[model samples]
Target chain A: SSHATGYNSNRILAPYSVYKGKAAFSLTPSLPTFTKLHSGAVVVDRRGSIMVIFMHAIGDRKYDWENRQRFALSATEVGSLLTMGPQDSCEFFHDPSIKSSNAGQVRKSLSIKPHANSNGYFMNLTVVNNLLNTKEFFSVPVTAAEFAVMKTACSFALPHIMGWDKMTHQQSTGGTVGLQS
Target chain B: SSHATGYNSNRILAPYSVYKGKAAFSLTPSLPTFTKLHSGAVVVDRRGSIMVIFMHAIGDRKYDWENRQRFALSATEVGSLLTMGPQDSCEFFHDPSIKSSNAGQVRKSLSIKPHANSNGYFMNLTVVNNLLNTKEFFSVPVTAAEFAVMKTACSFALPHIMGWDKMTHQQSTGGTVGLQS
Candidate 1:
């Protein structure tokens, strides 16, 4: 079926993917005076492959919610596989839109322990490391130089000038008001 | 200011960005019979530095909208830079969500002539070539192997598996009914 070959087939695990890994960092508050929710997981395949890791944070206001999803990879695994070179490092952030004043607020957070069980599967650092070290036919070696070029090109291609950092101050802090003609 | 250093600054030139290049390819219908709206632009700085290019597509239904924003770099520039090696080539598709049956329908498309005007800045083959070949302090050489690894890693990091390809057929085809629950 298409799932076997599709690059995005791994998304099938989204609903249950939340249970796969332990929290990589402590949850910290960013914007004060607002309710904040933080949740994250390191998803792995049935055979213990570390498919993805993501952290999401949301700041809740009376009328709107501010959210951010930070996605990343383990540097150790990436460095070993790609020979990323000493000078190479990478970081990515995507801020798509500004929340309108009338948008409703919803908050949900998941607490996953180091050995949480999901569908009878469990994951730990050893399992993740084993998966990373495994030699797969699909594994390819990438150089640091190539990564640098692509990064530069993408930066130039997607300029995030939406003033996301200043969003918290600009959002309406008062109760919602009905629209006036 | 951070805005000056930040890679993405709204570019305020979304309207003008379109004139910076030619249509890389014809806009062919992908999901037939459904209303399709496609918009694209190649954003550049006031000094004419190519910053980014983006295209958005939406398939409308009676109650909800199925939308996608596909971000890409110029193939001509990328292909020439890496030589792509023997095993390297890239294709991107974004399937965000399925359309609900009751979503409303709307369609619009933009026409970009080869030498359209944008704030008196017109881009053609020569302009693009000049931008790519310029000796910028930020320019870096990237290899094909590195690009492949980064691509594979990103796919696993962000999985958009909502069956957007099957959205056209599944959304509410009949009249909308009030929520029964």
Candidate 2:
């Protein structure tokens, strides 16, 4: 129970700092200065050195899923947001209104249309997050077609991974999942 | 390139020793004492402090996919197997012929029928590996229904995990997976 609780807490609490030279970011608004955002959940990347936190607000926990503007913030930007307080809104946009003297230095952000399905929203959020976070963005822009392909790939990979985990667990526990021993 | 190579090598080389107080096990037969067997791979469980190695023969790395008899070996049994030289064959079974007077003391093992599909085999292998490695196995037996659900959950979790990794990697490399600035 401790292990399970600990694992769950770790998953929900903050960004896992498994690798060195990376800044640790907290997802939960536990700090005194921190205020709760509209985002229901925050996802952290554990596989790589650069930690990414994807935050999106889902208005209600049950039924009526409405996604607010999603923000993909760096460690420094996150810290700034925390200090700015919850009352002040911080919007990330790729709009021309947000101008820079040098066009090359302009920051461009991606936006995903809100979906009625939670699964669709999660998948799209993941795809867009991946696209924005990748180094390839500087060289190649993610097209709508590529986004669709990535989403499809993520959808496909999900079942395989789960199936593998389930079968493995069943074997370990000596339980039959329709597989003859 | 280093990251990709490292990740691939880690996946194929040895069982991940993510927990403490568990014996480290190698899946590959790189040891001089190791004898090439018909089995394809081995899976280890971290929670129960047990290790199971499944071996299958790929033959010429092209066509032949013969499934050898699957064996689930404990840590002590694994040690004994390692001590076994290439000239000797290690046989693991729950055969009644190999009798032990004390039934309770007898080590139990699970077996799976051979599948023609490599993807199925790999998925099963991964599932079993994770099941054996988790902390929950010490307390609860994973049920067939639970296994199905867990597999489904894992399936969904995989793409998110992979997508996060890809994004993190791209960000680290400063390459675009296609977000315009």
lDDT of 1 at B18: 26
lDDT per residue (tens digit) for residues B54-125 in model 1: 322222311111221122232222222233334333332211221744222211121111112221211112
Whole-model lDDT, candidate 2? 0.28
lDDT of 2 at A158: 30
**What digit string (tens of lDDT, one per residue) describes model 2 on residues B1-181?**
4233321222211121111121111121111111223473222212122233333323432221232222334334444433432133343444322455543333334422222432111112221222234311111122222222323333333332222322344345556645577
What value does the lDDT take at residue B71 in candidate 1? 25
When candidate 1 is compared with the true two-chain complex, its DockQ is: 0.03
List the candidate 2 regions with Cα displacement exceeding 4 Å: A1-114, A117-119, A122-152, A155-181, B1-11, B14-104, B107-137, B140-181
Error of 1 at B150 (Å): 25
Candidate 1 CAPRI assessment class: incorrect
Instruction: Assess each prediction's global lDDT (C-alpha) against the native.
Output: 0.23, 0.28
- Number of the predicted model whose lDDT against the real structure is largest: 2
TM-score for candidate 1, please give it. 0.20
